[model samples]
Target: MKSETYKITNAVVEDIITETSNIKTFVLKPDKGLEFKTGQFVELAVKGLGEAPFTPSSDPGISEKIDMTIMKVGLVTDAMHNMKKGEILGIRGPYGQGYPIDDFKGKRVCVIGGGVGLAPLRSLLYELMHDLSRFEKVSLYYGAKTPKDIVYKNYVKKLQQEKELDLFLTVDQADDSWTGNVGVVTTILEDLNPENSIACVCGPPIMMKFSTLKLLEIGFKEEDIYLSMEKNMSCGVGKCGHCRIGNYYACKDGPVFTYAQIKNFDEIWD
Candidate 1:
């Protein structure tokens, strides 16, 4: 497992689905099938353009093809946005620790996401829904800057219709056609039964910070709050200090960690 973690395998871009104005999901077919834990990430790259870390948004159960939902945020992503169907990219990983799904068994699982952060959580949701009998309840609460900014439009519709899952959505700003809650995601976080439940959070650092505070106010324990910290992670392995946080490395020890494992670090939100 350690040997394959750093090896880059070639993958072809089979298709791309435009999710929003800024985000798109790339369907990649690697030379060999790659399997990863739901919340684990892969380092995707072009031969010369360099690599970046991204959590696969596809269900972990399907390893034949990997789906990566990326936003056009920087140079690498901009080039990727312009890539054609036949283009190739390098892939490395299944790295870092993923969501401990086994430990979450028999407990209520709440997933919270904002904007593109939903990409990673979507994979987790798939696994939860795949085996719904393992948990007591499964719920998703997600928010975006505006109705137009919401990713996975059609997929979210199906999520809403799933009888075993509870889904809630909110937008920071609403247009004339928007009918959902018209406030930040925290506005709809009320009435949560934090006891005996576990929550996973991912989003912009500011949104993550405040959402965590809200979860705490509602009585969620720090040990039960998992945060996805994917900031400035250049090299997926531990050698690169780009993702260092105090004594631990986000890309190595985590990208996923419970709140109690990292809340003491002052630079976590940075």
Candidate 2:
């Protein structure tokens, strides 16, 4: 694909569901449907302000529109919040290597996501749900700062009820109204028997670091554990060097990468 030549098709914003005070899910429809794999990401732009890479939170099957979970942590995201429905925006990509779903056929799958990290992970979970027969057992452990921080509340609930998959959740601090487990996401690592499971994880740098340790201690191979990374990616293509972590570009090489591929990079987990 060529760089800097993408068409500004349709950029209308659809539904805006506030997941939390700092997080919101934006639905966008491009001119043509986006055919993307589970772990791919796209670069969204607001003209002169800049562009940032975001993973699509919607399922791969539903391609007419894309869903992006944005956290209000930066200038561009703050501008995104003020955007109204039907407002035009610019989008490029469906980039990077995604999860190897075909290899997981009839194999156990484990997914761990924390905070806004659940955005990309949620899309994978949804894809697995649609093809339940392809995999043997599916398990998900999702965590957030508090009960209010959890995104896709009803969808997680539905996954628990309908699918045979084991769904676990945790929170940092609990209020009087809170009822789920109280701790970090790593707590759920104890429940998994990693004899034959492929795990994918996405979260803050600290969470990912500790989670990788726990997964390793429990017999999960480093190669079997995938981690999503983020640095400063200006251009989604390999032309820019901002997102480099050692020799790899977070935008081109991955937003999703196996732990084995990144263990040698000193600054990756920091």
Candidate 3:
């Protein structure tokens, strides 16, 4: 890691969009762009509370402001959720290896996400959607606890109208308003043509495990599958030892890794 990795930049809260009951998208404007790639993450710090790593959820092409979708899960996130527009937050780094978009060209792509896991994958989607001609096909399979808990309702609805992209949705438990599949996200992977394709997955531990298994069961190669570990990394740099999985430092080597690179680790899914 470089010395500059520890330096924090000032980012002002421009707006906050309530995505679901407990999830929000924070709009932050730094003096300049954070310029992060699709899967790389940054540390967002509250003035006094603390900081946590979050992947940027907005378009990778946009430069002025960045969007980070956060679930109110911990001390830093809880404080961030309570913050108002115009509050100044500290931003540092566009750390770790991002999705290698070039490798995805000329191949079918599947993005699988669960709950807030969609946040990081959302950035990859924007990059893929930016130039649809670069890939053979692109599809998204997502599931949440319920219809109301779905993170990006308007955005998902709009994707349906876009013929270029395929969207399949499901909820574990449904209400009257639900019309999609009602099982785990892996349920939707049954119909996909896993051959000549690559799948990128992010979610809670259980979700990541089954999604990987489902993808493998359906004929996807282990090396062709990508996962965002998104572990509780206390420091953005590898020295903290908080994000080490076996010999690899997930902070420095990857938050995004191919299944073949990490499938041997017993705690990978945890």
lDDT of 1 at 7: 70
Stretches of candidate 2 above 4 Å error? 1-8
Which prediction has the highest lDDT against the true structure?
1
Name the better of 1 and 3 by lDDT. Answer: 1
Clashes of each: 0, 0, 0
What CA RMSD would candidate 3 show?
Answer: 1.2
Error of model 3, residue 9, in angstroms: 0.7
Tens-digit per-residue lDDT, 110-150, candidate 2: 99999999999989988998878888889999889999899
For residue 179, give model 3's deviation from the true position in Å.
1.3
lDDT of 1 by residue, 1-270 (tens): 466546799999999999999999999999999999989999999779889999999999998899999999999999899998989999988788899999899999999999999999999998888899999999999999999999999999999899999999999999998988988889878878997899999998888999999999999999999999977777788887888887788888999999999988888886
Tens digit of per-residue lDDT, candidate 3, span 128-176 = 9989999999999999999998987888889989999999999999999
Task: Using lDDT as the measure, name the better of candidate 1 and candidate 2.
Answer: 1
Candidate 2 residue 152 Cα shift, in angstroms, is 0.9
Q: Quote each prediction's TM-score.
A: 0.97, 0.95, 0.97
